[model samples]
Target chain A: MTARLGPLFEACGAQHRAALIGYLPAGYPTVDGSRALLQAMLDGGCDLVEVGVPYSDPVLDGPTIQAAAEAALRGGVRLRDVLSVVESIAAAGGRAVVMTYWNPVHRYGVDAFARDLAAAGGLGVITPDLIPDEAQDWLIAAQKHDLDRIFLVAPSSTDQRLASTAAATCGFLYASSLMGVTGARDVVSSTAAELVGRAREYAPGLPIGVGLGVRNSAQAAEVASFADAVIVGSAFVTAAGAGTSGVRALAADLATGVRRPAPQPA
Target chain B: MVGIQPVESSTAVPDARGHFGRYGGRFVPEALIKALDQLTEVYTEARSDPEFTARLNGLLADYTGRPSPITEVPRLSEHAGGALIVLKREDLNHTGSHKINNVLGQALLTQRMGKPRVIAETGAGQHGVATATACALLGLQCVVYMGEVDTERQALNVARMRLLGAEVIPVKTGSRTLKDAINEALRDWVTNVDTTHYLLGTVAGPHPFPVMVRDFHRVIGLEARAQMLARYGRLPDAVAACVGGGSNAIGIFHPFIDDPSVRLVGFEAAGDGVDTGRHAATLFAGEPGMLHGALSYLLQDSDGQTIETHSISAGLDYPGVGPEHSWLKDTGRAEYRPITDAQAMDAFQLLSRTEGIIPAIESAHAVAGALTLGAELGPGALLLVNLSGRGDKDVDTAVKWFDLLEDK
Candidate 1:
């Protein structure tokens, strides 16, 4: 069961720490900004990152995230640019996972992508759209290249599904904190904690990261209590979408958010 | 685990996971994740509650005129070289299409959720018509986004939607067609997640939709099944329908998925020709990829960008089919074949002349398939085809294609 990403998890675990994960749409404002945002996320508080390879249609994303994707596409950010962004992020001492839809992956050739990501500074690849049953070819290639193939688990997953999904999962398990697309919400669901607990039971020892709709410090702190890592996607995307100063301020704000107590005390 | 007992009817319900044989699951972005989760919860409650089902059934029976009759097309059958042909009359429903079936269910669910408005996208305008009809009945503010090109070609449908009190917004982006309309509608839903519900037309999109739409349309097949038994005293040898995002085909095919004795064939439109780059035959020529939020077979370029697709029939001119349809094709549970514009036109004319029944250009694809398959099956075989919609809106196009304007 020992693998490449396992070492990073072990290192973080030994430090008695949690990872602050960030997500940014690749090439949102500009190519340079995309690379700079990755470095900023890591320098501020992010321990690991998810880089979105923008596609024409981003179905699961909320308005803020969708705007970021559209902006990235308009700026001529293709999947190839994402690889270069990962390479630069790695050079600057950051670890990232290319989070993309299956279209770009298929277009680039899965084997070639797996090899390139492994060579770049990427540790894993998470496809939110590909089910475990349909991920065999890519998973095999990812494993061959020593890259973790991460999968998304929702609260709606059945027991039979939970087992099969956990078996094939690598890296930290991604637990969608809510049921809908990515955006800030009024409050996090109480069931999210229970779902994460069930997922942790299924994939024992693997770190569980919760993402989607984790916006401010209060939400982040609450998620941090239950998760090994708290991933803020739309928040980062929304921040990076603003000018460079906004991105930095938002990243710092998120760091502060995660360190604060839960909005509603336990 | 070897011999699992069937769940008791008292306890049995649609899986909480929203799967129909492992094909439907939420595979989407984080932003709308909670919204869909909420929808799933609401839908689950609605599916199990007799009050919901009873009300929906009442709408279908009284308002939509459902349990829509099955007519034995003997004359049409004799023309198909003597194969016994049965037509399920979904075209008789309000709004003149099977699209009403799915919309009615979603509308009821929307009302249950206390949504004040409904949003939808349309291609050939059948879905827009149905959605508009539902909104009018429910008094929900209806807004339909249609591509500019479609609005021009389908002017009457646009007017019909307006008459039904829907605000038809002309989308002018990308290629200005169905795909762009969908993109705009999705953007709308993300922004207005609280007050609005997107009434997806077909058995496609992300998870819950394909499962939900298919469930609502399952009544079509269920009623047809009993009717066939009563009429023929035995099961049909094969079933056929056209595939445009594959909702109508799936509606009729789902109940029979486990029946190995029956063969299901879906026909896609190959405009001009399949090799001419002017066709919408996704299953025939497309590769597996993600589009409009679902992992399915999509007509796209090597760069993963969407490619332009064409079909004489506007409804079948989409670049992607439903994800379940792609899965079914891959698993060989259903076979997909292509029909050209000329052949469909021939079938369109034949059905109208023979039976005094005009069919939608999209449904004409299936009528063309029936002609070929019926001839091959000879005199004794039973074949059921879902006449999904009426061709009134398509009459102008049909007239132009046949050059009947000069004769008239």
Candidate 2:
């Protein structure tokens, strides 16, 4: 339930740090290999693991993540494969969430998908394309199944939408830092700070997680200063291509960045 | 067939969330939702404004040549066992295809919205050329994304688009085909939603696009229906058109959908044959899946990854059909058939020689289907077919296929 995710963020908040969330496609390279990589991320101190459900058309993904998803899809990854990964993460005592575009879930059946994901011990799902206004079926299904429905709030979203999206989201709100698709950037956008600030006005109790271009430790630390969670996706996916050791190294580095101490006042 | 009533109202479609029965919806990223919503609102207002309609109608009439005549081909009819075959000459439109109809309307909308740049994705480059021409006329910056393979196969169209002052981007990802081009265009739209308008070319995509594009081309059916009535004092026994994304077919079919007596037939390109597992026959062989922001019938593997589709005609070489076509198929309001590449080519050459009219390979699929239907209905049966485009773009491919250049 939503209460389960709160403790993880609360634990990080107690340490004066943001939660380190690492993402990797469910069947990257191979399904079993991806599970090993996910375990490495958790071992390296990622607070949460987001297992991507590879889709045919990932409109919101940048080239790096898109290539990884295409490879996973080519390798014959399906909803069942993703669920198996979730089960593995849960068994290892790591909180796992499914990040996917809405179509695959729609095709898989909403209520059935929610029930299966819950049974597999998935905390929730992050539907990148599903907005609060059009999320009635998902809302009902998530409520009935007691699963968290994470919604995305963009820089382009209006205040009314921000409020609605924050209100509807059961888990933390996903705040897209940039206007563009997911990728690593040299500098975090100035708008990300503004978006996080605005999200606070709308959803006071909800934690805001910033994603889309958080690459290195420096960028992660910068975002960690103003956000509750630093989501590193493409960087981890790129590291995943190298092997499990590469994933562990990147995850540890990012985890350290989220825990970096604030500057002492002069 | 199910006993669903034939759709009588044209505006009944797409509700608020853009569902044509169980088919269309906004299955795009959150980044593009605002743009889609803005487009839906602007299009709703633009459709009702007399000034907007006047400008669009004037341009359609004076610039693109509206009311393209219906030409009855008795000579070609001979091959069909004496069925009276009439062609709606959409090929006569400016840019040599029915693609211009949808672009012109969207381009007008772009200008009204104060957007200075327009982006589009194309398969065979007809839609790209059409978009380029509209952008050029409207003094807006134009960019077209096309598959790398399509650029090579349709080099002349690539040249035409560039000549029209549009930038042609060859996409090299994910099979390097229409589907990839669409993904790239969508990415561009999400990044540049403020200054750019994505001029979609067919009756597909997320919400208002399917309804808006279909309305823009509905003139094809309206004009053809009136002309057919005026000429023969009644509607044709059947109306047929090729189905790529189903724009041309929907355009010609919508006006006649209410008339149950008039059968609506759509011909899909079966690259080899449907049974061979290499074709673009989405309605015939595909199951419901999501692609390009719409949940419709698509050629996908068991895991739901889109499968590569094949067709000799680049325009018809797509794995997904428009959501409306899927709805029509499910409702049994329209019937769809598969026309193999060989059958389409046979009809292409037969029409060119018999009637001195070279049809686009995409349209030839419809012609091929009409021939079979004509034979089944026997003599005195009247058939109306939408000649969607000219074959000038396919001449090179034709020469290679028939080995016409080998003699030289």
Candidate 3:
């Protein structure tokens, strides 16, 4: 079954636009501060909010997100705090999901983490480092709890891997725009559209979310022109340093970018 | 996911997907799966290919000064209750450590993959030097990531790597040690997978790394076992080595795994003490957790955050041990113990004065443990220890620690 995300993407598809997805660390800056910032993002028209759990060794993240996460961890951000943030997002009438490396959830007991996340009003989890091959227990848990299992596909992924990943994923397939860690680049990856096309060819029914290096509205528009979802992470995390209004402002700008009509195929 | 048999034995460990009883498996990003698969395939094919084996064996003989001899430390053995203490002299290798064994093999693999650039992460700089050495010999571009703290702690080895034409990038993230360096190297691999091959130094990391690295260094055990049999007419009662990411220890332990009569002992670094919350003794005190692309024993907090680790020896100052080591510990096939800095230092000094051979601080941890094991085993019991690296790069730290360099 698809994530409750179907309606969100359906609404965007009706507008001939891509859904805007925003990412924020659950306890960044401060616990309550993150909730307020996510609230602002939702208010600013983000269709979906990804509540990131800060980890000690975030090998997948870029400098901005890594530094922010280190600060949050130093401030004693816990998993419960992440749940509380997701709860706040749900309480504020917003769609939410939790994204983190696999260890914390595995250490907490996979089934228990899934149950708690479901209870906390989170729809699913995005495990950047967890592929479908090594996600046996997590997959079982996500299924038992009716939670969406979102997996990523990279440009380097073989057709076999793309097909398998698309088959395993329930939510939108997270297509890494480039062969790099999480960070914003000067331009949206030139290979993103091509990768998204491959993903569409493989999945067919699944929505594709292009992420990594989509910082500004123009970049978002570029991604939205081809994919079903425009995912922005480092940009929002960097903007959070400027405070909630800044986050909301950027979210609104990005929200507008996703609604831009796709350029007619030549 | 493909199952790999540990070399020289029918041992069925780390089933496909690389799980050694839930300890070793790939826990990395999907972005790296293809490269890892490609590496696994190349390494798998290279193992049985006559030409590949001949090339690697040839380098080991000529380039790395292969079949590193076993030295009987008679004078030092007296301090250990007169036990027959034999040391496999990996320290005499060209790069001064057993790290060259795996580095050379992987460097060959890089050539096979047609990847011109090689990236590595180092703790004590032994592995960095070895990687750089192999890169130089093969004319490959090399970049080494070392913790900022270690570049100063191991300044001489840093210079050696530079002299070999390897770019050294000092990582300043997370505890600023080996763990962070690995993270940085993994990031670099993700960014440049097509152009670069991450020459993982130790037996840790994702899948094939643990088994592949173990296979490359398996020669240590294979050779030492034969030496023990030919010279002493029997296998030693025990084999001992320092456990950091467990490459050296596993190198000397693999062939002996099925030898029920022989004991396999690993000494993990205990900085101040295990109870002091500052030690790098993962097998001694850590719980099972995922770190650096594999499920293994790691020093992590209640929330599953990797605990910052410390050790007087930079090489042993890691929060995680190799997954196979974790499997060995769990299966009761091997035993691991904590060795404190003070004890390791005492052993370091003892080896220097008595045997006229100074060991790398990492190897000294094993020496310290060996003394205790020797005393327990008593006289006449044979103990084979892996003297993993030489002390040349550590002389500065030694002078400062022992106050050997006076104003004169």
DockQ, each predicted model: 0.20, 0.61, 0.86
Clashes of 3: 0
Which tens-of-lDDT digit does each residue in B1-408 have in candidate 3?
011133656568878778889898989999999999999999988888878888888899989888899999999898887688999999999999999999999999999999999999999999999999999999999999999999999999899999999999999988999999999999999999999999999999998999999988888988899899999999999999999999999999998998999999999999999999989999999999999999999999988899999999999999999999999999899999999999999999999999999999999999989999999999899999999999998898888889997787
List, residue by residue over B104-209, the lDDT tens digit for candidate 1. 8899989999999999999999999999999999999999999998998889999999999999999876667888788788778765777888899987777678
Error of 2 at A84 (Å): 1.7
- How large an RMSD does model 1 have? 6.8
TM-scores, one per candidate? 0.73, 0.96, 0.98
Model 1 ranges off by over 4 Å? A1-52, A60-81, A88-99, A106-112, A123-266, B1-22, B302-305, B406-408
Query: What's the ranking of the predictions by lDDT, best on top?
Result: 3, 2, 1
Candidate 3: residue B115 Cα off by (Å): 0.6
| True contacts recovered per prediction | 0.29, 0.51, 0.78
Worst 10 residues of 3 chain A by lDDT: A257-266
Compared with the true structure, all predictions reach lDDT values of 0.80, 0.90, 0.91
Residues B144-244 of candidate 2 have per-residue lDDT tens digits of: 99999999889999999999999999998898888889989999998899999999988889898988898888889988999999999999999999998
Query: Which 10 residues in a row give candidate 2 chain B its minimum summed lDDT?
Result: B1-10
Quick one: best lDDT, which candidate? 3
**Displacement of the residue A73 alpha carbon in candidate 3, Å:** 0.7
